[model samples]
Target: MIRLLEEMEQERRRMNELGQALLEQSIPLSEHDELLALSQKVDQLMMQLHYAKVEQTERQYVRGGTNFEAPSMV
Candidate 1:
């Protein structure tokens, strides 16, 4: 899961670079549409990546928290 998150981040950076490149010149109509779609996909993946990290933290907490128990009464 960590590896997957890292890969997604890399892809997001690549796409952002492409978006920036497009801004430096006048691109074709088709390229403009493709850039828009890719941008949306990058945004969606960022949200998913955030949730994945949150879930991972929650799971780790749950797994570690089971080691303690209450004492018995006399």
Candidate 2:
């Protein structure tokens, strides 16, 4: 989890650098091909982190026994 978070942070920093570069070059962000690719990668990492957290929660619940239920939002 720590490793994934670190990697995600690194990717975000890279994306920021790319965005700055595009702005400096007067290139439209939407038209930057590499930015689009990097954005997709960051999104994937976010999803991975989300799923990992969910899985960890489920594991904790299982370990706590079958009667454990997640709290309702409402």
Candidate 3:
């Protein structure tokens, strides 16, 4: 669980770096294509982070046994 969260965080940091670089640099069209790929990677990382959170929640509930229940939004 910790490891997954760490990986997610690392990816997020990398994504942010790429985004800032894209904004600050005035590169060629070919380089923009590469930056676009990094943007897609960011999307994929976000999905991974979401799923990891869900799985971690489930694991926590299971470990807590019958005492656990999903929280009410209200």
Candidate 4:
């Protein structure tokens, strides 16, 4: 899970770099499309990482039998 999170962070950095580069330079038409696709890919990767973390947390909660109780206030 940590590895997945790291990978997702790396991809996000790459996406940011790409955006910066696009703003600083005039890229060709094909390069624009390619960068857009890469951005979309990064978005998808982030979503997958988020879901993986959520699932892992759920599994841990279930396996550990964690109990949640409301506190009583007088």
Return the top candidate by TM-score.
Answer: 2
lDDT of 4 by residue, 1-74 (tens): 67767877887787778777877787653568767777787788778888987887788798986555687887
TM-score of 1: 0.58
Off by over 4 Å in 2: 65-74
Clashes of each: 0, 0, 0, 0
TM-score each candidate: 0.58, 0.82, 0.50, 0.66
**How many angstroms is residue 36 displaced in model 1 relative to the true structure, after the best TM-score fit?**
1.6
lDDT of 3: 0.69
Task: Using TM-score as the measure, name the better of candidate 2 and candidate 3.
Answer: 2
Off by over 4 Å in 3: 1-31, 65-74
Q: Please provide, for model 2 over 1-62, each residue's C-alpha lDDT reduced to its tens digit, 9 standing for 90 to 100.
A: 88898999999999999999999999999998999999999999999999998899898787
Q: What is candidate 4's TM-score against the reference? A: 0.66
Which stretches in model 4 have alpha-carbon errors above 4 Å? 26-31, 65-74
Instruction: Tell me how far the alpha carbon of residue 31 in candidate 2 is from the true structure, in angstroms, after superposition.
Output: 0.6
Candidates sorted by lDDT, best first: 2, 4, 1, 3
Shift of residue 48 alpha carbon in model 3, Å: 0.9
Tens digits of lDDT, candidate 3, 11-64: 668767766776677544346666577567667766777898788788878888
The CA root-mean-square deviation of candidate 1, after full C-alpha superposition on the true structure, stands at: 7.6
CA lDDT for candidate 1: 0.73
lDDT of 1 by residue, 1-74 (tens): 67667777887787778777876776653568777777777777778888988897788788895434678787
Question: Higher-lDDT candidate among 3 and 4?
Answer: 4
lDDT of 4 at 55: 89
Question: In candidate 3, where is summed lDDT lowest over 10 consecutive residues?
Answer: 26-35
